[model samples]
Target: MSKQQMIPFQTTLFVKDTCLCLHAQRAARALARLFDEALKPHGLTNGQFSLMMSLNRPVPAGMADVAHLLAMDRTTLTAALKPLERRGLVIVAADEKDKRRKVLRLTPAGEVLLAAALPAWRETHATLDQRLPDIERLRADLRALS
Candidate 1:
């Protein structure tokens, strides 16, 4: 088979400049870092805060539903829950209505912690929204991609 031509640095630069996924990923990491830092005093990272928030509900949420909402697989969701469980912030149990399905619930401590983290999350989120004009449009576009 003929050898493929080597790609040039200019093409790589063009890809970096124009790729939607690359830009989205970079923005996501940056935003996560900013929120993570903002949440440090509360002893939570952005991901943990999101995971906890996802479980906020009157009824415990099912594992598959949580995983789908988080855009993560079941295995990854399990790993993420480990630390929160250890901290007594989250409790996963068999769904009362359906014994086979595992349900996610925030413990009393988790509710308290999430309550405390809300102000921090709100502040950081507002800053992000202010920094990025047309944030609502951007979110809609991003959701379209998903």
Candidate 2:
């Protein structure tokens, strides 16, 4: 390749050090692992826990709404629901008023497990919150980015 087509090694180093996406992804994975380990006894991953938590409302949440709240596309959210559905932890069905629309809800067993898992989730979050400086601000910034 010609020099014009080459990206300098220094540029790679700069991106490695300063890319927000890279940093955020690395942090996300690490945090997922931490929470995954904490939730293992409950047979839930961090993502699954969050998904179930999203469905813990009085009314079954619309699939699109849950997808938006979780920052996931419908297909990805549907794929993620497979294991939970298989375990009877969540129910996905067509909305009553709109047959074409889908909705989701946690089962009674899922609620019980979520209640049981709350302490571990709280403790992990508390530890992370204590370790991070100005976590609220960090969260706000992340929200803004999203």
Candidate 3:
């Protein structure tokens, strides 16, 4: 084929020189879609599931701490929490010690929803593991990047 004809019609550029970011983003999006479908019955999106899981571990986490752990900016995290708050799945309250700070906690309803979603999550995770046996390696690589 001539050089002009061989060239692709369109080329997409990622934000950076590294493919790692793009690959991770694409993988996360795909996984989120799959988990979203699986968690639909429990009325939880993958993001909500993750947030609940994070809050389930401890009693009331400061918003900043939770945001840091989730690697999300405060604004973005606040936006994500709105739906959960509306659904009564989570509660956000001002920290008593510091009125300016907010704390996040999973409500009883959130716990129940998380419990209902766990089986679906496990099945999806297992399927992914079966498909990507090298996931551990990928995880290690990703950790190294971090």
Candidate 4:
């Protein structure tokens, strides 16, 4: 038999052009940069804004729920919370119903900050939606993929 043929460079280009994961990652980075710039006035990166937003609820949320909702592991979620806690924007305490379980809550300060941040996020997201029509459907599709 002939020597095994080497993998072709064309295959590399094929994957680069055709891979959904690659395209999704690139789009995610681009969107992150856009939102980061938009939210800079509030001293929040897009990730921090999203993390804080995840805690906006009628009740203090459990770490696991927030982590799962954010697609983050508990360790990563804990690390993400540290800066916000240091800033006194969020508090982590034992759950009332289950004392051993730590729950996350936004403080009054955090609520104020988030309220201020909302307009920027809304405008930026609206602009993005304008550029990408049917964005709600796109969001639903992306969620399905996730």
Clashes (backbone N, CA, C under 3 Å), per candidate, total 0, 0, 0, 0
Model 4 per-residue lDDT tens digits across residues 1-146? 89998889999999999999999999999999999999999988898899899999998899999999999999999999999999989999999899989999999999999889989999999898899979999999999999
In order of lDDT, best first, we have 1, 2, 4, 3
Q: Candidate 2, which ten residues in sequence have the lowest lDDT sum?
A: 1-10
TM-score of 4: 0.94
Write down the TM-score of every candidate: 0.94, 0.93, 0.83, 0.94
Worst 10 residues of 1 by lDDT: 92-101
TM-score of 3: 0.83
lDDT (Cα, tens digit) per residue for candidate 2, span 1-146: 66567888999999999999999999999999999999999899999999999999999999989999999999999999999999998999998999999999999999999999989999999999999999999999999999
lDDT of each: 0.95, 0.95, 0.87, 0.93
Per-residue lDDT of 24-115 in model 3, one digit per residue for the tens?
88978998999999999988889889988989865699888889888899999999999999999999999989999899999998888898
In order of TM-score, best first, we have: 1, 4, 2, 3
Best by TM-score: 1
Colliding residue pairs in candidate 3:
none
- What's the true lDDT of residue 87 in model 2? 95
- Model 2 ranges with Cα > 4 A deviation: 1-5
After superposition on all C-alphas, the RMSD of every candidate to the true structure, in Å, is: 1.3, 1.5, 5.0, 1.8
